[model samples]
Target: MKNIFIINGHQKYPFSEGKLNSSLIEKAEKFFNNKGFSVKKTTMEDNYDINEEIEKFKWADVVFFQTPLNWMGVSWSFKKYIDEVFSMGMMGEMSDGDGRSKEAPKKNYGLGGKLNGKYMMSVTANAPKEAFNNPNETFFNGISEDDLLKPMHLNFKWFGFETMPTFMAYDVMKNPEIESDFKRFEEHLTTNFK
Candidate 1:
């Protein structure tokens, strides 16, 4: 909780310029800074070194992801970043070769993480809140946001990181509630971190 690493996983498109995600990242940065925590950040649109990112993961006590849910998953650029960085990290930097050995190949599948930090994801989505956690909902059919984001959670789990509850600003495109979302975001940070 003392040192935090934030990843902004926003990829800009013609229709979506990533303003909301950027704003959320800014708010998180300010919150952590004011609380006297050391903060490091990365944006997918910017150039980064794989080794440096691994070092940041080692240094951080918590890793926060600020992303927009695009087509039910993270943006393509962020996915590429994950592939590159995590792939390089597999060389004992972040993990130790899938946490398995010749003695027991199937015993420990994903326990090769070198870092033991925590992770949280803050997401923006075009879908409404009601679309989730309601059995009547046609699309999700009672599936929660966390359920939708299980893959991303597993990614962090592979690195031995614990998961914090996720935050989501739903219906951002069709029903923008910028102010309310900002308020809730701040409250979430306070409730979780403070």
Candidate 2:
């Protein structure tokens, strides 16, 4: 946890411009800097080199993803970024071909990751908190936030990164409690990082 890489995966739209995500990133950066940790960041809207991103992952002890949930998943642009960067990283940078060998090919699937860092995801969603973890909820049907974000988690797990508890700002669109969310976010960082 001495070094951190923060990725802002918010995609801009006419209705959402990623201001909240940016603020969260800023807060995390400040928190890490105050704790004497080295911090690096990438905003998906900006042009980036894939090699540099791999290097950042290699250098970091922890990678923090800040994203806005769109239609139950990360934005399309961020998904594209992940597809590109992680694909390139497969060449011995982040992983070394799916962790299986010719001798025991079927035994150790997805065990070939080269990095040993941890990853955490903080996401914003338009859906209300009550909609999740309730078996009576029609859509989610008792699914937790982490369950909904399993794909993203699996991506990191494929590269051998450990999971950190996820954070979410629920009801962000219809009935936002921006100030309370920010406070809770700071508390999250403190509780987890300390």
Candidate 3:
């Protein structure tokens, strides 16, 4: 029974509402629940404790962050959750200023994460897949999902957690192939841990 931590950072307080993020979160919850794994879930709307998240992280063999891409980046709520859930006193001496950290302080991380012996992955949904593809003309960047999420991946790697391949569902909002993406995602979930 591998313990899993799932964070659904769809904020309803500091912002208006996020319907798609809610749906994706529910879908992910059911997916893990159906697998009979022990799962701990947190939604941004629920004023939950960061300690609970830490305890879950300590208990989990794996952690999954599932949510929609709000800006050209991750949701503000997700960033806040990361700040709260992965803050100091939890990372031991492995965190920054302990001398093991090699990251430049200007790059947005400072030895705060240390997910030793655990695995982490992401399920990110983006608005338009085509916009992020190579050779695109509009306001776009040509980076791949793994590249786009390199910061998060490296954060886990620095903390001693093995990071898995990021799973992305692009063109999620306007594409007609969303159901297909969901099916693929379902298959990904089943085969991922194996």
Candidate 4:
């Protein structure tokens, strides 16, 4: 069995109400539960613990960040969690490609991660996919999912852990698409965990 940490990085906001974020998070939670993984969940509005969550991160075999993308970026909760959690370790350490420091945590030891061996992925809800896909919009267009999450991915890489492919729900909250997104989140968990 795998240990999973689900970080609900959504803080209550105007655009965050009654949408894809809420539904998919519930779905993700149920899906993980059925898999028998010991799960720890943290919601943004709750007072957070840096060391405790980091300990959870170390305990996890897979860490899932379920959130809604806002302002063409991640939620403040996600950013705060990252800032608090990743700072405790030698998060950004790197040596020549050929070798790493032996005295400190190394990738081989799993402690090297900034929390390592643990897999991580992000499941995000966004506005209509088209809203973000156009090339004409200077601030929000012509960027693909991986491109948008480059900084985040780089952060994971800097710590020497592999990032799992993300699950994105576009135009979430409109009509039947919300249901489909939840279904996909469940599938994502089952597929990855198995």
Q: Any residue pairs clashing in model 2, and if so which?
A: 99-112
Off by over 4 Å in 2: none
lDDT of each: 0.94, 0.93, 0.63, 0.66
- Cα error, candidate 1, residue 189 (Å): 0.4
Of candidate 1, the 10-residue stretch with the lowest lDDT total is: 106-115
- RMSD of candidate 2 to the truth, in angstroms, is 0.8
Total clashes for model 2: 1
TM-scores, all candidates, are 0.98, 0.98, 0.76, 0.76
What tens-digit string does per-residue lDDT give for candidate 4 at 61-172? Answer: 6777766767667778778878776765344432133235666545444224443545555556445666566798666667777688777776666555577878887765
**Candidate 3 lDDT tens digits, 20-109:** 556666776787788787788777767777666667766777777765666645668777877666554345633443323344545534
User: Between candidates 1 and 4, which one is better according to TM-score?
Assistant: 1
Q: What does the lDDT come to for candidate 2?
A: 0.93
Top model number, lDDT: 1
**lDDT tens readout by residue for model 1, 121-166:** 9999999999999999988889999999998998898899999989
* Candidate 2 residue-wise lDDT, 1-194, digit = tens: 89999999999999998889999999999999999999999988999999999999999999999999998899998999999999999878899988889999787787889999999999999999999999999899999999999899889988999998899999998999999999999999999999
lDDT of 3 at 182: 74
Candidate numbers, best lDDT first, in rank order: 1, 2, 4, 3
Pairs of residues at least 3 apart in sequence or in different chains that clash in candidate 3? 96-111, 129-171
